[model samples]
Target chain A: MLKVHNLSVNYRGTEALNSVSLAIHAGELVGLIGPNGAGKSTLLKALLGLVAMHAGQVLFEERPLVHQRQRVAYVPQRSQIDWDYPVTAWNVVMMARTVRTGWLRSPNPRSRQAVEAAMQRLGVWDLRDRQIGELSGGQQQRVFLARAIAQDADLFFFDEPFNAIDKTTEAVILDLLAELKAHDKTVLVCSHEWGQALNRYDRLLLLNQRLVADGDPQQVMTLDNIQRAYGENLQPSERPAEMPFFC
Target chain B: MLDWLLEPLGYQFMRNALAVGLLVGVLCPIVGSYLIVQRMALLGDVIAHAVLPGLAIANFLRFNILLGSFVSGIFSTVLIAWIRTQTRVKVDAAMALTFSSFFSLGVLLLRVLGSRLDLMAILFGDILSVSRADVGRSLWVTLLLLLLVKLFYKELLFYTFDPAAAEAAGLPVHTIYYGMMAAITMTIIVGMQTVGVVLVIALLVGPATTAYLLVKQLHRMMLLGALLGVISSLGGMYISYYLDVPSGPAIALTSFAFFMLALLFSPRQGILTRRRPLRKP
Candidate 1:
């Protein structure tokens, strides 16, 4: 379980998030939807303690989030990473164990087995030896998913994991998320593709600088909320073409 | 060939110069890899040039060059890191501000100390004139720095690849970063004596950058970088000997030449100088 109370963030005197609060119970998959720069990524960063919170606290399992970092895993936007790094897919997945193993010790055999299983689950086991730079965008997203899986954490925060990914890869990732829910794990995903998120997530949190609405996908994802959050940004023809597939 | 090359090896000064080159060539790339990965290639050049005033002051004080360079390099690193962190000044502006200001101060110091100290010796190294004590000190520092890098190799890679993730994972990313800066400071300090400030950037960036163009793995890049460095050093030393040229420039040119070769000929990502023919344009 995770709780964020009265959270606000400011960057260079510009307020990114203004007194927003939300919570997710265990086993729930919450989709955080918003326009660009609407504090979606900032919320994730604040939860991960990567950003300085102007006010309020983040709690994981009733403790401060920073102290419970190991129990939470994050898959940042693939576009945000330097893909040219010399690390391999295996190395990226193994990085999940870094918090548990610490710097002085290497991952144990069991941890290695977990990493392998996670890679296999995500259909990236064969690509383990390949340099991360060589992978496609979908493959890169899968690698990050494998890393989160290998972390074996109770809660996962993914920032736009499905962006630029094909439909099949998106389905595979959704199925994996369903499996995580079955295992009573928590997932908070930030997605711009409302249709895909609606099909998979248990709850939808529509946001625009503040909590616009939070409820079931049907209740929260109304055209009014979408128009308000998006603000004439969506032309009728520009509405996601993939909504029918999800329906 | 062995007779001529072996003959020079018999001289103490020749041995010292060779040792100094070997140590510098090995150490520069180890630190330079991090610099390149972090997209901070020019930071080395900035730091090397920025430490000139400290070197000049140390020369005026008749202190050891390493001690002065270390202090000055640390000061510059702290200043640059602080400026980048505290103010909105971008990295390049901060580097330019710090490097130019300190370098000018060094010029001023050298002007005042011109009568007693040989500024050219510090600007452009006299590798052939390296004392045995200097060579010993270089060897000791290189060994210590390499050992530290080896011990913390994983942490360094993690920090370089993703600082935010590493910090969230509870690794001391800042500490590792500053520690690396310290290592770089030590490396540049020892390097200043043999390569001088002007040529130190060549050793710091050339071989490592060349290796980066050639390899995809960190460990392999490091090994290839060291190999490239040694080859450049040996080739430059020999070419300087035969052509009666300045050894420092020869070494830097040789390294630059290798970089060009790697840039042109590397298999994976080398610049394709010859464009593919357009199909039925």
Candidate 2:
């Protein structure tokens, strides 16, 4: 379980996240939804301690989350990755074992097996030898998904895993999330998706500089919540194309 | 052919220069591969130029010049990182500002102190004048850095590829970054003697980039880059011995020639000689 208390982040003196607090239970698939510049990615980065927080504390099971980083896995956005980097799919996935294997030593047989199994599970085993840039966009997404799977962490954070991905990758990601939930793992996904696809998550937290709504998908997807999170000036057409919003 | 190759070994200075050159060739590209991957090639140039002030100060105080330059070289990278992080200034502007400031300070110190250090020699290296001690230092440093690199290859690879993920996985990303900067700074210090500050970037970035075009993996790029570096170093020494050119420019030019060759003719990614779809069967 994860608990965030009064987290606030300021970027260049502008409030990016303001006093947002939420708790996620084990085996729950939570989707963090927000409009552009609503700090969805900023919130994830803050929780992962990748970004400095202005004022807040995040605890996993009563201890500070930063100290328990080993039990956490994060998949950053595709824009954050340099696909042209000279690494094979296998090499990218093997990064998961780097911290676990410790320093000054190569991956042991057990680590290697885990990497292989993770890649195979994501249907990227056959493409392991290919340079990551040479793989298609869908394949590239799968490679990172495999990397997250390989981490074998108790909790996982994915940033916009569905953005710009193909149907196959989306399916793979949904299945992985389901598998994690079934295994009692905690997962948080940042997404812009709305409509029936939003139902995939057990819970949704709509955010706009603060926590606007937090509950089951149906409870969080109300028009008032959408308008409050998106903005009062938002046109009907400005809503996510898949979800119709009637004023 | 044997006599032509053997003739350069007759002189002690040539032997020393060639020894230093070979060592530099083996070392620069290996360490420079990280810079290429991280897109921080200019940082190598910054450190190279930044060492001059340290050399001037050390020479003025009658200390070991190498120690002085190494300290300043590493310091320059830290300053650059600080400026980029604490403010809105971008890395390139920060590097340029730090590089020229440190270099200008070095020139001022050298002038005011009236030290015996040769500015021309530092600007454009005189490899043929190296003593046996230079060769020994180069040899030891190369081996030591190579060992360290081998020990931390996995961590370095992960950090270079994705610092955020590496950090989230509990690796000390800042320490890893500083360690990399230290390695690159050390490499520049050692290679500075063979090819002076001005041409050292050519040595650092040239062969690694050449290997990059031909290889898909970081290790392979380093291995092949080291091979190309050695060839360029030795070839430049020979050309300098025969054609009477400056060793630094000769070596840098030789490295550039190899890069051009790879650029044009690499089998996988070359502009020319890439197999067309018709030829792929």
Please, what are the lDDT tens digits per residue for candidate 2 over residues B1-281?
99999999999999999998989999999999999998999999999999999999999999999999989998998999998888889999999999999999999999999998788889878876699999998899999999988999999999999989998888998888888888888888888877888888888999999999998999999999999999999999899889998889999999999988988899988889787677554
Q: Identify the candidate with maximal DockQ.
A: 2
Model 2 lDDT per residue over A12-74, tens place: 668999999999999999999999999999999999998899998999989999998989989
* Per-residue lDDT of model 1, residues B142-223, tens digit only: 8998888887777777778877777777677778878888888888877776667888888888999899887777777788
Model 1, stretches more than 4 Å misplaced? Answer: A232-247, B60-64, B113-115, B271-281
* Per-residue error (Å), model 1, residue B192: 1.7
Residue pair clashes in candidate 1: none
Error of 1 at B188 (Å): 1.3
> What is the lDDT, from 0 to 100, of the residue A165 in candidate 2?
82
* Candidate 2 lDDT (Cα, 0 to 1): 0.91
Q: Go through the candidates in order and give each one's DockQ.
A: 0.53, 0.82
Instruction: Pick out the ten consecutive residues of candidate 2 chain B with the lowest summed lDDT.
Output: B272-281
